[model samples]
Target: MTRNRLWYCGITLAVIAVGLASRRFPAMLPAAAGKYPGDVLWTMMVFFGLAVIWPRLGVMRLTVAALAISYAVEFSQLYQAPWINALRTHPLGHLVLGSTFNWPDLAAYTIGAVLAMLLELALRRFAA
Candidate 1:
């Protein structure tokens, strides 16, 4: 992989780890910290995952695509077919395809996409 792609991959992995940790150790966090960070980090991971797939893409495009995808996944929770609900019962599925819909998650996704875009721009400036 190219250096940029490698960086994105590493970032994606790091975000995944932290997001999982946020869920795994929620007791260590304040009550207000409930699941919001994980959702934001999840969308951030999606942004970085897209960057890893298309490292040469513009940050704006990646941000749009990531937000589109994250929003779509969140909206998809409205569908509750047996197969999908069964899939959601699994740990990995629960992580990827959340079981329910929440308005706040859309905001979290937007924040994450913007944060990812800013991070990418900052990294590019730093590297240059």
Candidate 2:
């Protein structure tokens, strides 16, 4: 594989490790940190997942798309429709759909997306 592709792969693995730790080992973190790290990194992982599929895509465009999908999922929590709630009943669903609407999540997602974009740009400029 190419150097850039390898870098993306390494970064994706790191994000997954941190995401799992954020959820699985919450006690290791500061109380104030709460779940924000996982929330932000999870959203950033989503962006990286997309980047893995389309690495040639512009960072700005990927950021916009990722932000749109992340916001849509967060806003959908407001509905709590039976189907959506049922979806949340499963572990994977719970992780993805979430249970309730929180305005702070939007901020978290924005931070995640911007950081993902910046990281991608940096990787392209410095690592490439």
Candidate 3:
């Protein structure tokens, strides 16, 4: 495979591995949370944009979709909608958004997606 494809898989796999490993090990994420919201948001955009530009990767689209899915799940918690809310209480939900919904989370997702799209356009120009 090409270098960009390999980098894409490596970064994606490392992200997953670290995420899972940190769950079992339980100490890595809080430090990340320490980052300024602006920095975190920018990093999200950069990584997501790179995902689109990298050979055989589509990080930007996936990043936006993932944020949307996360937002939907978080919003669903407002309903106490039986299965949905119950599912929200589990570890996966905590990993995604925490136990409650906030209007700010929607704003974050929108901002993240918009930033990702803009970054993708910029990257495409450079790539071309």
Candidate 4:
């Protein structure tokens, strides 16, 4: 594979790994999330911004889809729908949506999407 592809894969894998590891072992992950919703939004925006600025090294549409899925999972957590949460407990679900969920997570995902678009525009300007 090309270096760009390798870098893309590495970034994607790293994000998945860190997200899953945090769920499985909260103690292992930093308590970086603050009570303030803005902080969470900012964090997500930054990460998604990276995806946009480095589109060639990442997959923008996939990243957006993943973020959408993440939001969906968070919303689904509200019902605590046994079947869904049970599915969430699995490695796959935990990695995708997370064990626990909250509506604010959706806002953060939106911030991420917007930031991604903005960053893409900025990168384009820089390139030009």
Candidate 5:
């Protein structure tokens, strides 16, 4: 893989780790820093994941793809078939495909996607 893709992969991994940690050790964080941060980080991870897959893509396109995916996944929670629920019971599955749908999650996802896009733009400018 190219160096930029490798960097994106590393960033995605880091975001995943931090997101998981936020959920795993919620008590360690401040009371104000609740579940929303984790969701936001998860969306950010999605953005970085797309960046890894298509590093040449522009920030706007990456943001759009990531937000679309994050929104779709959140919406998918509305369909609670036995099979999908069973899969959601697994830890990894639960992390990727959340159990319930919350309206605020859409806001969190939008915030995360925008933050990710700005970060990428800043990084590109810095690198240039």
Candidate 6:
């Protein structure tokens, strides 16, 4: 594959590693590093995933799309229907669909999206 492809692949893999670390090994992290890092990284991964699939998408458009999807997912936590809640009980589903709806997650998603936009801009400029 091309160097640009490799760069994107590497970034995606690094984000996955960070996301997993933020979630799975909380004890190993700093005292206040509970769900915050994971939440931020998770949204960042979403942005990176979009870039991987659609490299030419502009930063503004990508950021808006990422935020909209992340916000929708967060809002989805408000629905505690029996079946959906039951699905959330499973490990994988729990990871994907968080149990509680926190307003702070919106801020975290925004931070992640902004950071991803800046990072993407820098990468594109340097690559050029």
Top of the candidates by lDDT: 5
Supply the TM-score for candidate 1.
0.94
Over the stretch 1-128, how does candidate 3's per-residue lDDT look in tens digits?
12255554565455445445645654545765432243235334345435635554554555656566656755775776677667668877655545666666666656655655565566567767
Query: RMSDs, each prediction?
Result: 1.8, 2.3, 6.5, 6.6, 1.9, 2.5
Q: Model 1, range 1-128, lDDT digits (tens) per residue?
A: 23378778999999999999999999877989678888889889999999888877877888999999999999999999999999999999999999999999999999999998898878878887
Clashes of each: 0, 0, 1, 0, 0, 0
> lDDT rank, highest first?
5, 1, 2, 6, 3, 4
lDDT of 4 by residue, 46-116 (tens): 45444545555444563566466556656666667788778788966664446665666667667655654
lDDT of each: 0.90, 0.83, 0.54, 0.53, 0.91, 0.83
Error of 4 at 33 (Å): 3.2
Candidate 5 lDDT, tens digit per residue, 1-128?
A: 23298888999999999998999899988888679999899899999999888877878888999999999999999999999999999998999999999999999999999999898888877887
> Candidate 6: minimum summed lDDT over ten consecutive residues — where?
1-10
For TM-score, candidate 1 versus 4, the one ahead is: 1
Clashing pairs in 1: none
Tell me the tens digit of each residue's lDDT in model 2 across 37-98.
Answer: 87788778888877777777777778998899889989989997798899999988988888
lDDT of 3 at 43: 36
Weakest lDDT window of 10 consecutive positions for candidate 3:
34-43
Please estimate how well model 1 matches the true structure, expressed as its whole-model Cα lDDT.
Answer: 0.90
- In Å, residue 33's CA in model 6 sits off its true spot by 3.6
For model 4 the local lDDT of residue 8 reads: 38
Which scores higher on TM-score, 2 or 5? Answer: 5
TM-score each candidate: 0.94, 0.88, 0.48, 0.48, 0.94, 0.88
- Distance from true location, Cα of 68 in model 6, Å: 0.8
Residue 5 lDDT (model 4): 39
The model with the greater TM-score, 1 or 3, is 1
